[model samples]
Target: MARLELKSVRKSFGSTAVIHGIDLVVEDGSFTVFVGPSGCGKSTLLRMIAGLEEVSSGEVHLDGIRCDHLLPSARGMAMVFQSYALYPHMNIHENLRFGLVCQKTPKAEIEPRIQRAAEILQISHLLDRKPSQLSGGQSQRVAIGRAIVKQPKAFLFDEPLSNLDAELRVKMRGEIVALHQRLKATMVYVTHDQVEAMTMADTIVVLRNGRIEQVGSPAELYARPVNQFVAGFLGSPQMNMLAGLGLQSSEDRFSVSADGGRLRLQLARRAEATTGDLRCTLGIRPEHLALSERGALRVTVTGREFLGSETIVSGTLQSGESIRASLRGAVEVALGESVAFEMDLDHLHVFDQDGAALDEVDNALPVDSRQDEVRQASPHHR
Candidate 1:
């Protein structure tokens, strides 16, 4: 295992910069995921580290050695690409041994390496089969086995499961995680899928336009995003954003008012930011809202989607903003019927004028207080 580091790394295409100066450290034996939308420079960054792309103006180091100028093979890394990149005419055993053979490794050493990798990946029985003869998952295992035979310092995966069906993707994800635990190998994976990043990464590096947005554990990024972009980008079904103006402010609390409702929020501990009459965005995850007998906001249901264990209701708020709420139980509300909904104050998120998150939003209020405030202030309750 080896620690990987990028210091002030950058890339450009002529006058247009693709990757801004960025720094990151992937700890020894840790699974680090670089995730972002396309054109965000994630794959480009990965290629640079693999020595497939030249560094425009930065340093890449592996185990304390400057390796940016080294060849891909000399850098001691193995890469598994999205396409599998298999030799169609070669059997699984030959494919797995090809790299070692090309390096003129002794013939006596090649067979054992291939057999060991095949067993580890559970593809030993299919060693005689060609790439065209294997299933998608089986082919992926062969590709991974090929990397394993190299026994490099680190594994670099570029969307290695993007071609599989949803079920196979889930199965492969677990298998990969298991493989990591068994080998304890350092890994750097690149993907555009947030789900893949969330599920597999020990540390996630969220990227935007070739720049780092945030780096944290899955829970940290999901529960406390540093900006609106991170919050909106990381969640499924996305976060619901509402516009309102701050009405009251105090050291520990604040209130905001919209067209037909108001919200009271507790500030995060040590939160000393200014508050008063400022236009801010209110962010709430779909699962953080619920139907209530009394709430400051009322919405008319427009649609509903049943997602097995939960139901998602789409509606227009009194202010005409569309929002989605996830309910644990079945929802049978008719279209156009008004339903009262309450926000869980402890689960609320606030964003500044420029969409940056304020550091002092509190989420420690008692659940009873939150429900009480909604019940007491709502017109429907009175």
Candidate 2:
């Protein structure tokens, strides 16, 4: 395992700069993920690290050694791409050993390495099959096995699961997590999928337009996003942002009064500095809204979607803003029926006019109590 660092790394094609000055420190044996929307330059940065692309400026270091000038094979890293890139004519065993053979490793050493990787990936039985005869998942395992044979200092994956079906993607995700645990090697994974980043990464680096947005653990990014973009991108169903009037006070609480409706919210203490009748936005996750007999704002249900264990309820607030809430299970609330829902104030997220999060707040309830409520409310599961 080795530590990786990029200092003010940059890349540009002609006069058009894709990656701006970027500085990042990837700890030893850490599984770091670079995630963002398409055209965010995440893959460009990854390729720069792998020496597939030249750095416009700054340095790339591996294990404290400057390696920006080294060749891709000389950088002590193995990369698995989205395409699998398996040799169609070769059997799995030969494909896995091909890299080692090119490096002129001993015949005795190659077999042991191939066997061990096959055992780890549970593809020993598929050794005689060609890429043409294997399923997508099996082909992916062969590609990973090829990387394993190199025994490089770190592994790089570029959207390695994007080609698989949904079920296979989920299964392969678990396998990758388990593979990391077993190897404890430094791995850098790049993907546009927030779900993949959240599930697999020890630390997630969110990027936008060639610049790093935020880097944190999955839970940290989910619970305390730095900006509206990160907040909206990281969560399923996204976050609900309702435009409201801003109020400044030391009490750490604010209320939104719009269209003859008012909703009071407890904001983080850092928001106290913001003043004036500024146009602010209130951000709340779907899970934070709940049915309540006596609530502040009123909305009429517009749609309900049942998804087995959970239901997504869509409604329009009096101000004509659409809101979605993830209820535990199927709900009987009729469309166009007026319903009142309460917000968990402590769980509320506040953003400035620029969409930056104000501060972090601890608003999680005990897990056991939450599970109890879900069990009691969702009759289909029981």
Candidate 3:
């Protein structure tokens, strides 16, 4: 296990910078995931830590030692790429033992290491099979087993399951989780998939154009996002955004009006922030909305999807802005029919015109994270 820290780390290609000055810390034996949209620098940041990319500035420290100047091998790290980078001519046993052989590990110790890794990955029976003969899932396991024989200080994975089918991806997710519990190894994974990050990470780092949007546990981010971007990025169905005007009500309550429909909101802590006719945006998740007789908003259904246990309805709100509702059971509703939906105030989120959350979180987060300074995004970085 190892602790990894990045202090104002940066990277650039000539005059164009891909990764801005960023700082972070990954605790020993923790699984940290880097998630964002394409060209958001998640993969580039991971490659920097793996020593595949040189640092233009700042420092990378591992276990209290400055390691940015060291080679990947000397840094005691193992990387598993998205593609199964296995040697086709080599059988499973050779693939597992290749790293040990490269390090000139004693012949006596190589066999036992290979045996243990093969057993741990449940690939012992496939030792005699070549890469060409194995399935996608099996080939990926061999690649992971190759990394395990090195006994690296940390494991770095770059979208390691993106090529597999949906079913195999789910199965691999469980295997990786079990492997982490059994070994307690430090891990850093890079992916654009939100579902994988939500399901597998102990901590998720949301990035955008080389800057971190937010960092928190899966539950923490889901319940309390600092801004509209973070809220809209993490959820599966995504949060619905609606424009409205807020008026301060007496007794620490507030009211919102959109298209002549009024809804009372209770906000006790931030009464000062809600004074006057404030223009703000209201956000709500699909599951937090339900059909009701006296609902505040009415929608004309445009689409209905039955997702096994849950039914999702997509329609335009009273204001014509689109919104989705995840109601209980399978809902059978005809297209263009009007349906009333009641918003759960407990799950409702309010954002200012600038997309900052109206609710003030009193927790002590990092200084760099609290300040959202960003550079002009280039067209190439999309």
C-alpha lDDT values of all predictions: 0.85, 0.84, 0.83
- After superposition, the stretches of candidate 1 with alpha carbons farther than 4 Å from their true spots are 259-273, 363-382
Q: TM-scores of all models? A: 0.92, 0.91, 0.90
Say which candidate scores most in lDDT.
1
Query: What is the alpha-carbon lDDT of model 2 when measured against the actual structure?
Result: 0.84
**Clash counts for the predictions, in order:** 3, 0, 0
How do the residues 1-382 of candidate 3 rate in per-residue lDDT, one tens digit apiece? 4999999999998999989998999999999999999999999999999999999999999888899999988898899999988888999998888889898889999999999999999999999999999999999899889888999888999999999999999999999989988889999999999999999999999999999889999999999998899899989798988886775555455666553344444454363667777788878899998776556567778998888788888988656799998877777877888777777767878788888887742221112321232222111100
Instruction: Estimate, for each residue in 219-325, the C-alpha lDDT of model 1 and write its tens digit.
Output: 99999999999999998888999886666676666665554454444454333443666677888899988887676457778998888788888989768899988
lDDT of 1 at 69: 95
Off by over 4 Å in 2: 248-261, 266-269, 361-382
What TM-score does prediction 3 earn? 0.90
Candidate 3 Cα outliers beyond 4 Å, as residue runs: 248-253, 259-266, 269-273, 360-382
